[model samples]
Target: MAGKSGRTIANVPEKSLKKTLFCWEGMLVVLFILINVFCASISQSYQFENVLREMPKYLTEMFLLFPMAFILVLGEIDISVGATVCLSATMTCMASNKGLPFAAVILTALLVGTICGLVNGLILTNFQELPPMIVTLGTQIVFRGIAEIALGSGGSISLTNADGFRMIAGKVGIIPYVFFIVILMAVLFSVVLAKTTFGRSVYAIGSNRLAAYYSGIHVQTIRLIIYTVMGFMAGLAALFLTSVLYGANTTTGNGFEMDAIAMAVFGGISTSGGKGRLLGGIISGFTIICLRIGLGQINMNPQLILIILGILLILAVLLPNLSARLNVKKKA
Candidate 1:
């Protein structure tokens, strides 16, 4: 091909042939469009307004997905994030009930969540022997237990002054305010992971922690930072979640960590870590949300919906391994 200023034209590079192939991200784009079509077909109520109305509930989980990707890329899991959300929401509600300013309530949520994350980080970094899954499981129980205690016998609390929350839950036109925030954070996180050296180090750590440390990647430091960021995101999630519900309960964030993990895995992020893009995870998160909304509108069984998600998760993990093995067999 020749350009306007062509000195000499070179043939199109052979490398361009490989670039034309569909990668996992490309597959996701196709899947996303198909899912939307499926959803729109299944239920007449699956229109834009209905979807937007149902989306705020799901968007809270998207906040967690961004940080969870970093943690997964570091070859670690934090099951405690759901419980952190519960505790943060509980604290935020309590603060608001006590006549504290709305700003203080928000700060309370962030501080409590960050502290929970920091505790997890400190334990993991300091002990170096405990597995992340086990450590986070322990914290998960403790955090949710704290929320239960805070709620006392009732086990739930409603907002007396919902004025502040109502402001946040407000929509511009038909779109909720939280949607914009989710998009903004998604763009920011995706850029950091794909285009930054720190992101490369996360992949290195996931590939091999010892090798990363030896290469002076500050493995523990990065782990700490990621964990702390996870907590902060959980706090933000709780804030928006409270706005949606106008209160908090012991179960305020139950199963959120799993939901985020499922979205990440379904989007092609390896639970084993070191491979995946945040962009895929973001698209997958919304895909799942829309699917659930469409299903709910049609009066589908909730349990059946869960079963479908579980199947999707298994296929997401298993198909890649099976495909790789088949490729190996062919090469052999």
Candidate 2:
């Protein structure tokens, strides 16, 4: 029988000795229900479109999460993603503000992000010494610091391409470009993760780096590709953020790294790496946005919303670990 998302309970085969159980998804479902009910009971302003309005932002989160999830499954982490967003958006603003053509500015923004990622990939692959977490951490500071200097106390950038950019933030027949991007990215990521040789290499690396290297997987090169993708996705996110805000500034994607990482982790990417799913990430995005909205509906403090998210995050990580240990004990 197929697992969660695209599945039916009646399709289960009786002869099967076991079924793949996703306790994590079950938790996600419960969380979703609780949030919904919580909002229904207390929220006065809840609306159908309000929920729908969040889809694009959800997808925006996915653009970054998918690749990060891929890297996480390969047992790698990039803490600098948030900084990368700040840098990419800032560059977009700087280019446009400096009278550069919109097309030129857009291209520059994407290329800068790609180059930053290329640096990340190169250092991780060649140095054979610099840890991704630490390296990305350094890059994060460098990127954000550049933003602080370049923007010089400016919190937002006015988009000269505001009319063109509105296409992303603007709605079309109840559809958001952001949501379209998320779904497209999801499909692309799913194909890469489940269908490609490179995808298999990613899993192999996550499962065992030494074994992956010995198996002629060109682990280093693949690492470069992954970071590059990660960087590129950040650039795409910058475009959307710039379009929505009609400007780019240092704070445009601030804390985004944490949010993206949280969604990935909530979706089931293990901190130890090599175990997660796309559906998990999607559910995670939905849950976070929904939770925040639900809380706001009830007049809950925004700070409390953050605290609840922290709790959910903790439970999400711990539940699987606890389940695994229980199974081991039972087997023993």
Predicted candidate 2 versus true structure: per-residue lDDT over 1-332, tens digit per residue: 55678775666446432233435665676677787777767776666677667556545666788888888887878888778888888888778777776788778778877877888899899887888889999998888888888877766667665655665577767878687778788888978887889788888888899999898988888889989989999988887877766676666676777777788899877867667776778778777877777676667887787788888789878987798999999999
Clashes (candidate 2): 0
Best by TM-score: 1
CA error at residue 41 for candidate 1, angstroms: 1.7
User: In candidate 2, how many Å is residue 189 off?
Assistant: 0.4
Q: In candidate 2, residue 319 scores what lDDT?
A: 80
Q: Which candidate tops lDDT?
A: 1
Give a tens-digit lDDT track for model 1, residues 2-26.
Answer: 6889765778645453454466766
Clashing pairs in 2: none
Q: Using alpha carbons, what is the TM-score of model 1? A: 0.93
The worst-scoring run of ten residues by lDDT in candidate 2 lies at: 13-22
| Superposed Cα deviation of residue 22, candidate 1 (Å) | 2.5
